[model samples]
Target: MKALKKSIYAEYDVHDAFQKIVLLEMQSYDGTKKQQLKAFLEDMQRSGCISGMISQFIYHADCKKFYIEHLDDLEDIRKEIEDCLGEAVKDRYGLPHYTFMCWLCFEEYCYDIYRNSFE
Candidate 1:
């Protein structure tokens, strides 16, 4: 994990890259956030490419806030997310050891990380 974090840090400034990942993880469980993501995940799981699924999500997230009229500051943040997702997919995948159900369960794990980070 340290190696992965370092590699992502090299590609995107450490602060921005980590922040987005943390933010995504955090919001992933927020009630409203979960509702939004539930819809996306239903569609995403059909793709069957764990890496691509994660990448597309990160891609859309990086670009999401910027689509708002007053959220230009998010553009750079979005770009960084895209870069990380690109790198994560290039090397990683849905953990094959885990069943799809288990993999989906891991999203809750991510939410845990985000929650812990904030505390």
Candidate 2:
């Protein structure tokens, strides 16, 4: 996907946007990959291809070593915690199913609208 092929700065920009929504709405992202997983989980309920999404998010976060040589988004770091949690929950049901799905859809829709507006 073009999004996956994009640079870490692009990924970071997306993550930062996610962080803003999470913070303004009291969402969580405890400084780990767990946030991505959480986003994927919610997405799975709707897309059913969350594993790929989760993988993409993880790769994006992991690539920070290459893209981010100085500072990280403070809110994004917090949300990453769920990315860590997502790893442990792959075999469990601790993830929020429906709410996460709604959130994922809303986030994606918002992202598309925002992206379109920018262009």
Candidate 3:
């Protein structure tokens, strides 16, 4: 993965940093390589690196790649998410993709949404 010098949410608040990090990581996948991204998410979930909530959310959001413009809707949930993830989300600077997954898991805790599977 290429190092992200600056992020899409660089001008935004620290709470939105996960959006930027997710975007940077998504750069590795394109429409043609969506399967690889999906598989990676699935494996991460299976290995307990990502929670079931995040894995389901990704599938529901169809996040084969990141959508920079869609991050606005997530703002309302940011603080709740940060709080749920605690120290894992403290630093908005240079967070890796794996860490971002932890932040993503906060969505479930924040919204009280849980799904057994993405299907």
Which is the winner by TM-score between candidate 2 and candidate 3? 3
Runs of candidate 1 exceeding 4 Å displacement: 1-31, 56-119
Across 68-105, the per-residue lDDT of candidate 3 in tens digits comes to 33344344345545665673344343444434443444
Q: What are the per-model C-alpha RMSD values against the true structure?
A: 12.6, 14.6, 12.8
* Clash number by candidate, in order: 0, 18, 0
* Candidate 2 similarity to native, TM-score: 0.23
Model 1: number of clashes?
0
Q: Which stretches of candidate 2 lie over 4 Å from their true place?
A: 1-94
TM-score of each candidate?
0.22, 0.23, 0.27
Residues 1-119 of candidate 1 have per-residue lDDT tens digits of: 32223332233242344335434543544455544444433433444334544542334343243234223323343445457568422214443322232233233334333333323
TM-score, prediction 3: 0.27
**How would you encode candidate 2's per-residue C-alpha lDDT over 26-119 as one tens digit per residue?**
2333433444434533444455323443332334343343234323442343345347456422313343433233234334433443343333
> What TM-score should be assigned to candidate 1?
0.22
lDDT score at residue 39, model 2, on the 0-100 scale: 51
Is candidate 1 or 3 superior in TM-score?
3
Clash pairs (backbone) in predicted model 1: none
Worst 10-residue lDDT window for candidate 2 reads 1-10
Relative to the true structure, how large is the alpha-carbon lDDT of every model?
0.37, 0.37, 0.38
